[model samples]
Target chain A: MKYINHEELLKMEPQYRVQVINSLSGFKSANLIGTRDENNINNLAIFSSVFHLGASPALVGFISRPDSVDRHTLRNIQQIGQFTINQVNADFWQAAHQTSARYSDGECEFKQTGLTPHFIDNSDAPFVKESQLKYALKLNEIVPIRLNNTLLVIGEITDILCDKAAIKADGYIDIESLNTVMVSGLDSYHTSKRLSRLSYAKPGILPTKISLDGKS
Target chain B: MKYINHEELLKMEPQYRVQVINSLSGFKSANLIGTRDENNINNLAIFSSVFHLGASPALVGFISRPDSVDRHTLRNIQQIGQFTINQVNADFWQAAHQTSARYSDGECEFKQTGLTPHFIDNSDAPFVKESQLKYALKLNEIVPIRLNNTLLVIGEITDILCDKAAIKADGYIDIESLNTVMVSGLDSYHTSKRLSRLSYAKPGILPTKISLDGKS
Candidate 1:
């Protein structure tokens, strides 16, 4: 095993340190966050930091850096108060990754990556047409992490659109069936193989594998 | 395609809604957080909400519900001001999931789940002995998500221990090669296959596959 103490980590080259620190968090969701500015310009950027916050309110949160390529996304979401999160799949991950490229405020990543912008009646934000699972979110809160100057943007799900076949009877969306990709560090993409869904854990009993369908 | 509006989502049964909403966040990192209370009780809980916060100060953050099984983890971290985040690998995901069982205050999940507790001189928190990639962290900040009543606990990395073979030339840890598993919809565990590591995206240039060696 390799051991890196705090001082050693701090001494690492900037680029090397970034990769190491980013990858340390393990696999992250690969989602393209879609937003439209007040000017109606569509913005799409890949994010691996999105995580579930709550279920009853259907809240989701993602970290945004004020100064990175994500600045456009952060700015757009604030201006419109709504955004879309679309899962990146195997078919369009390359184009999805390209959305992270730094583009000027006037540019649209959809056009640059040849991905189509999708519109819905309820929200101004655009969704990725290539995404099998997508949702619309209205900004609920922006909490600043003064420690690192990053913002944790929380949003409430307002609308969800997905392929009907992916939803199981019990409400689990078969993302593996949809070829959804996961990300590691800053640049690596991966597709997963299911290792079975375990049954609910209880203090005295071990959990067994449950069926994908609701019948279990 | 199936469309679910916010009203319809809110009307679903709680069990169904929880599963659906959790899945909508897409794949999440599977990590077991280890902490010890002042009474010397070790607490281990599986968390899917951990995400990378920043790279320079080597920050990481994860969500903890004050009322859920995570309360033990939250309380322990607040007491000791330190904890460990261990990547849940394929071989022990079942056991990792078991750690989520609602064990009592005196009950140690490490004992209940049969996962060994490892200790080093610098911190009192226990690391999972079976994890190939594990790191120690000191509590940085605890931001309250007032909307959901959940807490976002931030930590700064202090020590990292990993299999040296998993580290690439440029410092990207090959998590897939380390057999780390991802979680979806609370119970479903997954092992990933690397699609590719892509070059940094540029406005007009498409990202190409970069070798693991980082020589490109």
Candidate 2:
């Protein structure tokens, strides 16, 4: 493999680089933003850049660049103090895509794209009216990355909203029943489906047997 | 969206939890791990559990259960003081999967899987022989997640090793071209391909332009 420096790495142009990141974050499906009118005026768009930060506080974040001036999503998050991460399902991929358009600062994506906005109960945050899963994050910290203009927006998962019925008794999130959109970088969409559930194990260890068929 | 409790969330098993995490970590794309193995017990494994921790020290980590009864990969890092992270690609997925096998404590996954092992000048941790990108990581604090028996293995990424050709001029890693596999949930896999890349902005903000055309 060829090891390149930052100078050489940054020479690839915006479009090419975005494609690579998009591939990393895109492909699976789509998602939409669920923000309040006041905040939507600040202008927020959702990209597949969104990813799970950790489970302790149930943190999640997405990468965003400046509106055009090239500020950074971390900046807006700092201003907002709180932001809602709404899961995109098949139902809202298109509307979510529309939100991606660089709209004016004062524009309301909900009205323009027709995705309904629902205020969450636990927090004073707006949510995707139809999103089956939503998260209210209290901005924790915005960590910049090694790569050129990228930043990791970390947050404290203050509140989690989900379609409880979709959550399995065993704690499995049954997004498959809801058929939500799974996104990669961009231009791709997927539905939630179960393939095979692997049995748990530690490396080089055998699971204890409760009973050997006929032998106790 | 329905909100569930921590008890209900914890009830979910690790097997299922891992899959959910894989999906969340950009669905398990390959990354490069590079280090020297002074112990001579070359350890190389592809983890969908691997993720970008705080980028400040350029940290990244992957969670692994004990190799055997009480053998822990984390413990190895703690004792050895170093390790490498290798990004997975189509070229090495099959071989990488083999490393996931529960090998005996003394066994080298590189030998057991027949995957080549390579090392760099700086460290003693061996990297996956076929990974296109690799990194040298110094052991950092390990935080045990409050959940069942899982751990948040944290490492500080000190140096990066990559194939310059795979890196784009825009600081983007063209992982799809590198043929990396993305994981969702436990066993599901998604092959990455070029999609769309967009700048970050609030919803309905102007100056929206897609960076990548159809082809990258």
Please tell me which predicted candidate would have the highest lDDT against the true structure.
1
TM per model? 0.99, 0.63
Question: Taking the tens digit of each residue's C-alpha lDDT, what string does model 2 give over A111-147?
Answer: 7777777765565557777777766667776654433
lDDT (10s digit) by residue, model 1, range B90-178: 98999999999999999999899999999988889999999999999999999999997999999999999999999998999999999
Q: Single out the weakest 10-residue window by summed lDDT for candidate 1 chain B.
A: B207-216
The reply for model 2, stretches above 4 Å from the true place, is A1-14, A17-33, A37-43, A62-76, A144-151, A163-166, A174-178, A182-195, A205-216, B5-34, B49-106, B118-180, B186-216
Candidate 1: which stretches are off by over 4 Å? none
Candidate 1 per-residue lDDT, tens place, A1-216, comes to 899988899999999998899899999999999999888889999999999999978999999999999999999998999999999999999999999899999999999999999898999999999999999999999999999899999999999999999999899999999999999988999999999999899998998999997455
DockQ of each: 0.90, 0.22
Worst 10 residues of 2 chain B by lDDT: B18-27
Candidate 2 lDDT, B66-108, residue by residue in tens: 5232243565677788877776665655555556566665777
